[model samples]
Target: MKEKNANSQSDSGYQRSLTNAHIQLIALGGTIGTGLFLGVGNSIRRAGPSVLLIYLVVGIFLFFLMRALGELIVSDLSKHTYIDFIEKYLGKDVGFITGYLYWFCLITLAMAEMTALGIYFQYWFPHLPTWVPGLITVAVLLFINLLSARLFGNLEFAFAIIKIVTVLAFVVLIAFMLLQGKSTSYGPVSFANLTAHGGFFAKGGIGFLSGFQMVIFSFVGIELLGFTASEAQNPKVTIRKAINEVPVRIILFYVLAIIAILVVIPWDKVSTNSSPFVQTLGATGLHNAGSIINFVVISAAISSTNSVLYSAGRLLFSITFNEKGKWNQTFGHLRRQLPQNSLILSAFMIEFAPLIIIIIGNDAFNFISSTTTSMFLIIWCIMLLSHVAYRKKTPEEELTDFKMPGFPVLDYLTLLFFIAMIVLLLFLPENRIAMIAALAVFVILAIFARIWRKEKTE
Candidate 1:
């Protein structure tokens, strides 16, 4: 492997304390968020068993997309992120828009995770205010992150292990129930649940398509692997191994878990008001299943919030480093190689999650969830476009062994998939407002970038 700048302590002037294990676990922690633990309930309700197919399809496309991302970063190890390549290949305007959008995007997602955390808390303390636990979640994660980068990694690793074990145990429990010919209200614990209840495509084509919106959203944090590239121990080997294993992990964690739930309890029994995992386990006579699943999903939410806050901080630090302004400079300050100022600012915005919950009450999580998913899809599309541009400009000799499969063709197809997702968002009544919000945010940011550029030129 090419080793340029590989030995530098801080390749991008940021601490590189994350090891291969940390990279893998952080990626896992990020991808397997509250989206799976809670949001899957809504998806299962929407499309019945057909949601499984949606998950599989979205996972395949994202895996290809990550390969494009991995190839670009490893090809030029010195660049902090694909944002750098975005500027080089696409233009300064796109890079500027994407940088700000990406930062704001993850911050918005942090808010959504915070909202989910508050919901999880309601499971334990049914009468207590959600904002209380929501506030506590932000404070706790903020403190761990402020301590150090390695601490954040270690914390996320622990969170990932909890979720991993929970899902694995879930799969095993469902299998045991099926082996004993256990039956529930929906019928026996068997694969027949997939087709028994109104058939596999029970909800028909539109219902199946609607599920894609949430299904795709569940994988929003998959690109977090690219974000951790700057801090990884061996950018080349570590990233390659992590990205290469995503498919298997997605299958084991997402696909199999969903299958197990539907197999044990019919899709109709999976309530939007609670976790499918909990509901399935409850069907099998586990009295404490609800509390157990509650803790698992809570950990998943906190894990995602922790990872995304770190991401937003890093993105702000990068954008500020490139801008020439006093506030930007302040936000870019580092202490012990941690982006302390940026993190504080990010945390302050995230703290709004509780207040939003208090005001909006019941609808807050779904609203933020749809908005976050829309923004991430936009970012993913931009990354693929940048990748296509990079391949055209670079010499074949410079391409790494980790190159994207079916290069330009797969790139455009993935972009088309994202477009389809956006269109699907328009079809869902709940997502329409969030979709409009995403467009309005983009337009406002684009105008802001133009003014910033004109001011700089003068």
Candidate 2:
């Protein structure tokens, strides 16, 4: 049997077109999405100002997670995606299972974003159907993705700039308000708001724990930088820099922004029904603040959908590359040096967003989005385990400089942290069903993988 070269490109034609700037912005754009723009209010309402701590804790673990992944990518830049590393280190069946599971979750995530896009559009155009905006947005994004990887990077770059500017401007404006001793309908803009309501853990320990599910969801796409390595201009420099900046991005974008909102609106008064960004801006008497924030939120959703589609397409192509069968041949090959077929199939799957919305109504978006957090927790655990395996198999001298800090100890600790979060999700009543459903999907995939292995052997 021939040894599979971990550094060999699985497919022939992916262009190394994503520059450092593109990779940086893509990392920024992936971490800041509708979850932060629209869903933070729910987290705040659940955990109070302690949500700050929740964000910080989750951010730290995720930074460690990225370090493990960075080490893997730096060790083998020629591999198309992290899935390749999984296959190499953790058997072919596990790789097959993880790849398809990841692709499925991404498609569902894109659908949720599409559903949110429709709702955001309804804010301005009340008469439009909920699905129309989502359908149109998916169509346009699919077109952009099909054009080329560079074009996709360019669009994400533009979208990320809009998000970063909005967040920075909000934080700065809130700081000025605090310094000026500003007053709003709720109360004065003061740091006291953070603790005055109920001493930080306003909702008690349960609320703080409950906040993890959503906050963890907010960071779902952070690993997207791993997917970009195959197409990135220089994997070592660009990937390492992007991963190293995870902590800074989390603090600046999530922690500071949430702190600003809490200072302006007491934890008890923060509306869980809508974006705190829109609420904070509106309270400040900014003319058309709601409209402007709405536009930004819409762009955030589109940015998420675009990035997920790009990942889904590549993942599908990677998993199916060089496999036997008509389906594999069709999706595995690149057209015009791009994964056009795989991309089209992924986009087409997202078109079901409208039908899902029509069938399940508004709950569809929350249900789909919630399920992804549970699914990703499982995937992250597997990736961490794969990292452990890689370390055990490779001699120390063969390892790259971009190694995971604390080596074997921190690696196991990170794995345990993720496992604890998974257990927490199962205990939460609202998320229990979603978590169980995700587990069922994993089991089903494992069963299929077994059959697939048997067939391959035969």
The 0-to-1 C-alpha lDDT of every candidate, in the order given, reads: 0.84, 0.88
Tens digits of per-residue lDDT for model 2, 1-458: 12223233333468777778999999887888978986788788989999999999999999999999999988987788888899999999999999999998898888878887887787789778789998988899999998988899999999999999999999999999999999877779999999898899999999999999888888887898898877776667888998998999999999999999988889888765457788888888878988898899899999999999999999999998989989999999899778899999999999999998899886776777789899999999999999999999999899989999998888899899999998999999978999999999999999999997998899
RMSD of each: 1.7, 3.1
Q: Write the per-residue lDDT of candidate 1 for residues 1-458, one digit (tens) a residue.
A: 44434334555777778888898887766668878988999899889999988998999999999899999988887776677888889998888889888888888788888887777777777787877776788888888889988899899999999998899999988888888998865678899889988999999998898888778778887887777877777778889988888899899999999999888877887878666776777777777987888889888988888888888888788777656689877976577778899888889888888877888888887788889899888889899999999899889988788899997889999999998888879778879888878878888888998998899899
Reference-based lDDT, residue 316, model 1: 81
- Tell me the lDDT of model 2 at 435: 94
* Model 1, C-alpha of 94: deviation from truth (Å): 1.0
Q: Candidate 2: where are CA atoms >4 Å away? A: 1-11
